[model samples]
Target: MAGSGETSEARALGEALAALRRDCGLSQAEAGARIGMTGQGWGLYEAGKRSSLFRPDVQRRLTGALGATPEALMLQAPGGAAVSTDRPKTSHPDNAPAHGLSARGRAFEGAASDVRRLRLETDELAPWASAGTVLEYALGRWPRRGQGCVIQLQDGLRKVRLYDRADEAEMVVLGAGALDRSERIARSDVQSVSAVISRLDDA
Candidate 1:
C-alpha cells in the first residue's frame, strides 16, 4: 500500500497533467488518442490511480501527447500557473523604420542593448538560419518550442540549434542536419541556453 505523502504527490501530478491537457484544448480521450491510449486508461492518470505518472518516461509520453513539455507540466502543478511572455507592443521614433530598411532590418537596428548578437559561419542550422546570418538572442530568456537558441557549452563552445525540450539532467535539441534529428545533451556540459530573438541576413 502507498503512504499518504506519496499518494498526495501522485494526485498533485495528476492534476497538473489534467491542467496541461485542458490548456491544449484536449479532452482526456482526445489527448490519449495521440499516444494510442484509451480514454479510460488515460483517466486513471488524471484520477491519480496510476503511480506510473511519477516516472519520467510516463510524464514525457503523457505531456507529449498533449503537445507539451514536462517542464510545462510542473508549472501546471498545484499552486503553480502557466507562464506567459506576452508584452505590450510599443513604438518609438528611434525604433521607426528607416528608408530602404525592411521591418526586420529596423528591428535589428533597434534591438535592445541587452540583446547579444552572434554571427553564424556555417550552414549547420540551414533552412532555419544559414551561414553569415546574424542572430540576436536574449541571455536568460527560455526559448519556446521550435525557436532558435544558442546553447553554450561549459568549454566555451556554442551551438545554434532549434529548441526542443529539457529536463533536469538533459536537453533535447534538433541538431545541425535535419529538423527531425534530435540530439540529447547533458545539462552538465551546458553553460547557458539563450533564446534567439531575431535573425538578420548579412549585408
Candidate 2:
C-alpha cells in the first residue's frame, strides 16, 4: 500500500534500474546471479513490485552491480535536491579495478559511511549469509558476541563468521544458521575483525 508519491518514485526507480541493466548488457538472470537471487526476484525490482528497492541496504547491491550510483538511479539526491531524469555518467570508484567485480560500486554514496562491500562466496554461513549475499562491513567497528563479522587472518585468509567471543590470545566464531559449527583461532593469527553492519537482501 504505497501512496501516490511513493508509487511514482517506485515506477521511476524501476525504469532507471531496467535501463541501467540494459546499458550494462546483462540479462535479468545474470544480474540476479551476481547478487544471489533468481531472475524473477530481480525482475520484481525492475517491475516496481517490491518496496525493498527504497531501502538503503538493497539499493547498495542493486546499484553496485550496475556500476552506478543511487543518484544515478534517482533514489536519493543531495540536500533534498530534486532527482534529475537524465542518464547519469557512470563513474567507478578510485580503486574499482583492484577489487574486480566484488567492490561496492560508486552507488549508495550516502550509505557508504566507512563501509566496504564484500560478496559472500560460500554457504558455510548459510541462511544467515548464503553464497551470493552482499555484506556491508564497517571499516573499524568491533563485533560483539553473537554478531556477524569478517575476520582477516594474518596468513591472508579471510572468513565470515558469527562472533562468539574474543580475548587477547584467541577468538571464537560460530557458523551461522543450522550449521552448528564453531571454531577458535589464536589472536596472533588474526589481522583484523570488523562487524558486518548490513546485508543486502537478494532473496
Candidate 3:
C-alpha cells in the first residue's frame, strides 16, 4: 500500500491532470486519443478522478497529449508497489525505462529511481507531468492491441495515431509515420505501456 503521504501526492497529480484536460476542452476519452489510447485503457485514465498515474508510458502519453514536457507529467505518477523503494539509485523518468524492455521491466529499471526520488520530494513529479490524466489511444491496427507498440525507438518518443474507428477495435493516431511488420511488430520499435493490470473495466 502507498503511504499516506504518497496518497496525498497522488491526489494532487490527479487534480492537475483533470485541470489540464479541462484546459484542452476535451474529455478523458478525447485526451487518451491524443496520446493513442483506446477502449478501456484511455477511459480509465480520464475517469480516474482519484487514480494515480501508474506507468511511465502513460505519463509520456499524457505529456504528448497535453503538449507539455516530460517534467509536466512526472508528478502524476504516484508512489506504490515494491518497484518504488526497492531499487538502485536513479533519476529522470523519461530517461529511466532504458527502452527495449517490457512495460513492467521498464517501469522497474527506469521509473523506479524516479519513484524513490519522488518520495523525498513532495508528492509530485516536478509539477509538470501532472497537467492531466492524459492517455494513449489505439495508434494502429497491425498486430492487434497488446501485440504492437507505437513509439520512437531511437528517441523514445511515441509514434502513435489519434482516435479512429474500426471493426476489431478502436484506433488512435499518435504519429504519422507508424511502423509495421509482417503480421507482427518488432518490440524494439514500440514503447510497451506500463500498467498493474487488475480486472477493472473493458473497452
lDDT value for model 1: 0.68
Question: How would you encode candidate 2's per-residue C-alpha lDDT over 65-173 as one tens digit per residue?
Answer: 5655455566432222253332332443443321211223333455366588899878888778888999998643456557787877767788889987654457778
Best prediction by TM-score? 1
Estimated TM-score for each candidate: 0.47, 0.44, 0.39
Native-referenced Cα lDDT, model 3 = 0.38
What C-alpha RMSD separates each model from the true structure? Answer: 12.4, 14.0, 16.4
Number of clashes in every candidate structure? 0, 0, 26
Residues 1-203 of candidate 3: C-alpha lDDT, one tens digit per residue? 76776565555555556665676577776666544566356555544433436555344445445544234434333432222222223443534554432222121234343221111112121121221323332221122233323333444554322222222122332223332211233444554332211111213
Off by over 4 Å in 3: 38-54, 74-188, 191-203
Clashing pairs in 1: none
**Candidate 1 residue-wise lDDT, 51-128, digit = tens:** 877664466557655645455666677755332112212321334421110112112333356479999888878888
Please say which candidate is ahead in lDDT: 1 or 3: 1
